[model samples]
Target: MVAYRSKVVERIELPARERRERALEEAGYNVFELPSEDVYIDLLTDSGTGAMSDAQWAALMRGDESYAGSRSFDELESAVAEVMGFSRVVPTHQGRGAENVLYGALLSDGDVVPNNTHFDTTRAHVANQGADPVDCPVAGARDPTADGEFKGNFSLERAREVVDDVGAERVPLVIQTITNNSAAGQPVSVENTRQVREFADRIDATFVIDACRFAENAAFVRRREDEFADYAIDEIAREQLRHADAVVMSGKKDGLANAGGFVATDDADLFERCKQRAILYEGFPTYGGMSGRDVAAMAVGLREAVEEGYVTDRLEEIQAFADLLEDAGVPVYTPPGGHAVYLDAGAALPHLDAADFPGQALVCELYREGGVRGVELGSFAFPDTDRPELVRLAVPRRTYHGEHFEHVADTAAAVLEKRESVSGLEVVSEPANPELRHFTAALAPLSD
Candidate 1:
C-alpha cells in the first residue's frame, strides 16, 4: 500500500522521566490529573482528538453561521443520508449529547434498555433517566483472550430472557453498539445485527445502534463476514444501518471531526420526539449543540472516515501496536478491536487485587516511565461491575504515524520490565456523586 504523507508542524518537549513520575505522584497517581504539557504520547481516548485533514479545515472556513436553517446543517444532513442511509438527522455537540437527547426522549421510569454492552456514558444516561440498562453480550466476551470473531455480539437467548423477564412493553429499546467500546472495542458482526433487528421486531421494541465507531465496525464486517466479503465498507455500513430503527453517533470517534454528534432515523415520529428533546437539552435541531463551523467540518469528516484506504490503514496500525505489546509478554485482548488496544491489567499484575486498582497502577506507571498516558477501563471506571480490569490505549485517527505506536509499545515494555515494582492505587478522594467517578476521583499509592 502507498504511504499517505502528512506534515507534522508542531512538537512538544517532554519533561524528564523522574519529573514525570513526581508529577503523577503529586497528582495523586492519576493520569487524568496530570497536565498535557508534561505528557508525550497521550492515549487517554480517541474521542475528538484525531487530526483533521486539509479538506476538513477548508470546510470549517466555509461554515454558515446562521442560527437556524444553516447551510452547514444541510450539508451535514446530506452527508448523513449519503453515508449512513439516515434521512432525518439531529445534530449534537458530541456523542454523549446525542445519547442524552435520544434516551431522554424515549426512556421513562421503570423502563429497561438492553444492549450488548453499554459504555460508561450510555449506562449513566440510562440510569439518570430512571431506566435500567442491561447487558446481553455473548458469553465469550467476558474472556480477554477469546478468539471469537464476533465477541461483541448480543446473545439472542439472553435478549429473549431480558424481554421475557421485564415484559416487552417495559422494554422500550434494544441497542447494539457497533464496535462495542466496553467489550474491548470488539466489532458486532453484520449477521448478529440482523438477528438483533429481528429480535426487536418480535418484542415490539425499537432497535437502535450506538454508532460511534460504525465505520470501523463496517470495515471489520467487510473483512470478516463471508456474506459481506465482497461488499464495500460504506455499503456494509448502510446495510447495518438499514437494520436499525435509529442510530446515535458521536462524531468525535469515527467521524474524524474535532467534536460533533447526531441522532438519526427514518422513523418520523422518533425523529420528532428526539428533535424536541434535542432542542430542550442541546440546541435547535438544525445546529443542536454544535456551531455551524463544527457542523461543516463534521460533514467533511463523515465522508472521509469511510474511505477504504483510511479505515484499512487505521485498523492495521492499531493491530500492529497490539502485536508489539503481546510479543513483549504483555497480556492484551487478542485480535485487537477496531480503535484501541486493551491490556488486561488483572492478568498482567496478578499480585494486586481489583480493590487495589491494578489497572490504575499500570496507567500511572506508563505515564511516569515514558510520558505515555492511557485510561483505565476497569475497576476504576465501573466499581460495582464484575468486568475485567483493562487499560485502553486508544490511538487517535491519522494523528501519529508508525513510529509513535512503536514508541508506545516500547513504553509498555519498559513498564512491564519493572512490573513487580509497580504498586496498586487506593482511592483517596472520591466524589460525592457516584456517577462517572473515575473522571474526577483522586487516588494515592497503596502502602506495600
Candidate 2:
C-alpha cells in the first residue's frame, strides 16, 4: 500500500531482463541448492557462514572412523567448551532445530519472548511456541555499521528499557552476535554485549544468543575494538561467550561444516531439558544428530573462520563491490560495510505502485544481464505485501572476487540506463496460502 523512491543510477536505456530469465531457465539446475553448495554471498543469510579446514575435512572423512558410531560427542563437547565456555553443551541437527527446542522449552503459549530483533528461524520458533516475540531494538542501535560490520548488534538501552517495562521475568532478553544479518551484518561490540548482558542480569531475566555467526563476529571485534584488537580470535570468541547464559548456533555458519548445530548454556536444569529435547528431534546428545566428519569440520572451521584476515577479507570484498556500485552512481545502501550490497529499492523505485514489483524488476534485470542472482527483499525476503519492495544482493563469501564485482557494477549501470524498460513483477499463482508463491518470471513495463 505504501512505497518509497529508489535511487537506482541509470545505465542501459532498455533493460532486457527477460533474456537473462531465458538463460537461467536454460541452465535449469538452480534448485535453491543446499546452503553449503550454493554461492549466494549470503549477505541475506548466515547460511554457509563457515567453511571447514582441511584438517577437519580429513578427520570427518577418515575411513577408520565410524560414520554411524563415533566418540564424536567428546570431540563436540570439548569444542563447545573451548569455544563457548558454557557450563553445559547440547547438540542439534541445525540452527533452526535448536531454536525450536530452545524456544519451545522456554516459552509457554502465553509467555512473551523478547530480543533485540529475531532472526527468521528464531522468530518462527517462538511464534510456534504459541508465544509472541517482543522486539527490543537495543541501545539507540541503528546499524552501528550503518556502515556494515557484518557482526550482529542491537541497541542496549532499548534492551534495558524493554526489560524494565516487561519486568524481566515476564520477557526474556536475547543477545546474538555476528552478521546481525537482519541489519546488514553489523558487529555487536564486546562492550555492548557486556552492557546488554548486564542489563538482563539486573532484571533477573534470561539472555540467549543466536550465535551462528560467532566466528565472523569475533574476527570483526578483534579488528575494530581497541581491547579486543589485541586478542586472538579464540580469546575474543571466549569473551563473547562468557556474556550469554545460553546460545543457539547453526554450526553451518561458524563451524563451516556441511551441517550441525548446538545449544550451549550454563544453566544446568535448562541445559538438560534442551539436551533431552534435542535428542528427540536430533540424535544422541553426544553427536546431536551429526556425523563425526561434520563435528571435526566444525571444530576446524570454527578456528579458521576466526583466523587472521579470514572473515575480514570476505567483508572487504562486499565493501569493494558496494564501492563500485556507488561510483557507478547507483544508490547502494549508505556505506557499504558487509558481505553484500543491499539495494534500497524503496528509494530506487519510488514510482513502483503496489501492483508493481520494483525489487523484482531490479533483481530480474541484474540477473538477466549479469548472470547474477540477488534476493527480492520486499515480497521474498521480508514479505510484507503492503510494504514497499527492496532488493538484497548477497555477495556469496567466496563465489566471486573483484571480477564479479566489476561485472555487477557495469550491469547495474546498464539496468539504470534502461530503468523505464524494466518490468514489474507478474504473479503466476497465489495458490492456497500466503507463504506459497508460484509465479512465472514476468515483469510489467516500467511506466514512463
Q: Alpha-carbon error at 402 in model 1, in Å?
A: 1.9
By TM-score, how accurate is candidate 1? 0.98
- Candidate 1 per-residue lDDT, tens place, 25-47, comes to 77787787888889899899999
Provide the clashing-pair count of each candidate structure.
1, 44
Clashing pairs in 1: 283-288
User: Which regions of candidate 1 fall more than 4 Å away from where they truly are?
Assistant: none
Task: For candidate 2, write residues 200-228 as lDDT tens digits.
Answer: 77777677878877766777787778887
TM-score of each: 0.98, 0.80
User: How accurate locally is residue 409 in candidate 2, as Cα lDDT from 0 to 100?
Assistant: 82
| Sliding window of 10 residues with minimal summed lDDT for model 2 | 1-10
List runs of model 2 lying over 4 Å from the truth.
Answer: 1-46, 49-52, 63-69, 138-152, 160-167, 353-357, 383-390, 426-448
The per-residue C-alpha lDDT of model 1 at residue 351 equals 85
In lDDT terms, which candidate is top?
A: 1
